[model samples]
Target: MLSDPSRKYRPFPQVNLPDRQWPSRTITQAPRWLSTDLRDGNQALIDPMGAEKKQRFFDLLVKVGIKEIEVGFPSAGATEFDFISGLVRTGRVPDDVMVQVLTQSRKDLIDTSFESLRGARAAIVHLYNAVSPAWRQIVFNMTMPEIKQIAIEGAKLLRDNAAAQPDTDWHFEYSPETFSTAELDFSLEVCSAVMDILKPTPDHPIIFNLPATVEAAMPNIYADQIEYFGRNIPNRDSVIISLHTHNDRGTGVAATELGLLAGADRVEGCLFGNGERTGNVDLVTVALNMYTQGLSPGLDFSDIDEVIKTVEYCNQLPVHPRHPYAGELVFTAFSGSHQDAIKKGFAAQAQRNDELWQVPYLPIDPADLGQSYEAVIRVNSQSGKGGVAWVLEQDHGLKLPKKMQANFSSTVQELSDSTGRELTSTDIWESFEKRYHLKGDGRFRLIDFQESQSPKQQDERIFAGKIRIDGVEQSVSGRGNGLISSLANALESALGGQLDIIDYSEHAIGHGTDARAAAYVECRVGDGPVLFGVGISRDVATASVRAILSAANGA
Candidate 1:
């Protein structure tokens, strides 16, 4: 047994929101989405995105319906400042879009940020400062009043800078950077002081962005904090609340959703949650979540593959295959039960004409994101008959019967087990052709065939064929109730063996005059082991005769 490290680490205290209203709340619509891919996501990449890459990413964000984007932190470096200036000078920012630039709560940084936005049509100047007790005591060694004053001074500078830029429209935003780890009442107090300095009204409301900068607590606790702040913050009618959550606790998406229910009006994050440390909240996941619930998320990810390609190219990071909605295998089924359920679910869906998606093991239709059915049902050693039949039907247009599916699945399983690897549709089709389609030459080969009905009894039939048995050519004929039974008799007589046809089936392999008929035969010889065979020909009767001979040889 091991003792807990209580002395070294303490649990984060929960928010004291006894009357929290988030539990009864539900998200009925999409929030205003702001992407931070260029600023936060670009900074976290080992190789930061270049100017050209940033422009490409900006275009992709616009295509995906992101109206607000944090383009860069201009005061950080020349490259960042130039990137911001380039977008402004190039006329890359759309008229409906508002590009935002971030800065620290310092005079030099704020002034530099304004300088970068000098030629832009309009922009949001986001100012932030650390207000947590830990940051104040450990990093700055400042008292509560000192930290609050830093925010107020930054607000005054933003107001003065906007007053100076009369030709351009300016929107102001402020963040208590690590709001999740700060005292709730004190954080509200600092934000109120900034509001007093800015004096924002409903007509031109300022955005008060609360960030889960560290994510030191549970998602519900963060939600509780957001709800409390929304209820108690001064000038509530004159402010817009936004959330910026990080994923250090692996629950940033959950926190953001709950924060929306807690009455936040906007969200700020990056694609695939790419950011510093454990990264930011994944905006793609949040938006698509709303899409699945019948609420338009106001974003277009209908072609998610294109989004992944662009993001990976710009960030030089491979999206994990297990990432929700945008991954390579998000809609794939590998387990036996999962494959079976998916197969039956598709079948049931085909019989209906409704638009409601009810497939098992899939919350949303893969086709909605531009994925194909071939990628959904895959085959491996652990796969079942349903998976094998699904592959055959999708790839080769062969809808195998239930018993044939089980029989063929065993063959596939044996091959997969021997090689210890997954099998492709081509591999399964090849195996089937090799094992069953012995039409030309075998122990018993059918060269030609003919059929006739009795004059007195129309149901009575006769089959005749020219075949070779053990390299000897012979002619044989037999009478039975149907064509397949008559063919079985002819094959048995020609080969001098007792052929008992156990089962048989036939279907057209293609369409129109170019189509060929395929026939499957299962038979046993003198109580020996049962074997299966396949045949194809332009004539259905001829294909049946060939199938009988192949099964006789196989037995």
Candidate 2:
């Protein structure tokens, strides 16, 4: 890497707009979206989509509520032309949806582009030419007027072709290929000349696509350029200003968003941002961002996983596991602090009465996109008590008390650290059962138990039960204020130690005929530290007695 990068590189110039209104504006609705996955996206792939893959992708885009789809550049090859022709020939194009095809500013290519969509009900014929200074001087070696004439001629060809095919509804789109680096005045002049030849009306609007072909400046500068064009363009109501931003600076999504606020009406991109270089702006991220801000993006992503699978299969590219809303790990929390906050957020959300979504570190609900809550909090060495407790409650229906969660977290932490890996819900539950003696016989076991009110004291209760101590059976009897207290007394008398019940809690594990009770006890025997015990049964009283014995055995 060069230590002095300024010696080799220069900074991009800023847009000349002092009073840009986009800064004070907010996006209130979704823009008209165009998916260029089959054109721009496939062109960038090492292994582009074949006939079957392209058809599958087309079906997916239509299912996802995209009204305009740029199917392919027909003049590129027979494969491209055949696919577009098939859609028209087979009557696959829906009445409400429009298929768009791309072409350069030439006679034969334009004719072939029209031939591909010979009988479509409606379609967009898009034309583009490079007009940036670098292209004019270095690539084409042409003057500004020569470049402007290319767009003018292409617009006329597009107009005449549509005139001949009067049966198909035709919409024309013109793009200044490298508008991101071209002079604003020259781009406007080219578009104006094209619009004059097309002679668009408010009912039949022309589309002027301004692409950040190579994202050259900050996003705000692009917004300034868009606002400038919208402010000065002729026949504003008869033209729909569109934006096609690339991610060269890793800000394509940002530029598209700001451009919308800057008065653009349409967006063009691919699913998961698949295109050349850093790829096009992600339509998924931008749409979901709008959804989070309470605006409907007019697209369906309810089954986002299915969308990811289709895109991966068609593009032969794996979507990153950390991609914004569609990634596998975007909704999972493994950090102690993050897990704790998310756990608390879910708890709070369940109690709220409103319909709005609110959760910490999560801008959107995973369930809204067909994701379950089981993966939200995973346990590793970095996890805290909240995460462990969440896993237990969600998977096993064991709501450990606050103190119990803290107590058992250390055990789990030690296991995770020693194993040096993540622990599944089953691993946590099995360890919990073993730690508290919820299953199998330990040092103490309850053989039989009975409770009755004392005749001497109306509030006092008597407990008489047979308990086994290390394989020795014995009968023990004690009296106390309640069933739990009397059990504690009986255990203390038989075990020869002072048992102090510090904390206790219980809840139903399930519902209906299969319901079972779970009881937790925090107790200290003599001078030892506090220990936790858990017991489960159909009878609440039996669960409580078993819990006392479980804790006493630990002592």
| Candidate with maximal TM-score | 2
Q: What shift in Å separates residue 465 of candidate 2 from its native position after superposition?
A: 55
How high is the CA lDDT of each candidate model? 0.84, 0.89
Tens-digit lDDT track of model 2 for 1-555: 999999998888888899889999999989999999999999999778888679878998999999999999999999999999999999988888999999999999999999999988999999999999999999999999999999999999999999999999999999999998999999999999999899999999999999999999999999999999999899999999999999999999999999999999999999999999999999999999999999999999998866876676567576676789887688988798998998898999999998788899999999888785565322221336655676677568888887888889899888867986546666788888777777746778888989999999999999998888888888988889999888888778666777888999999999988998989999997888997888888999999888888787677
Q: Each model's TM-score?
A: 0.68, 0.68
- Model 1 per-residue lDDT tens digits across residues 169-221: 89999999889999999999999999999999999888999999998889999
Worst 10 residues of 1 by lDDT: 376-385
Question: Lowest-lDDT window of 10 residues in candidate 2?
Answer: 375-384
**C-alpha RMSD for every candidate:** 12.8, 13.0
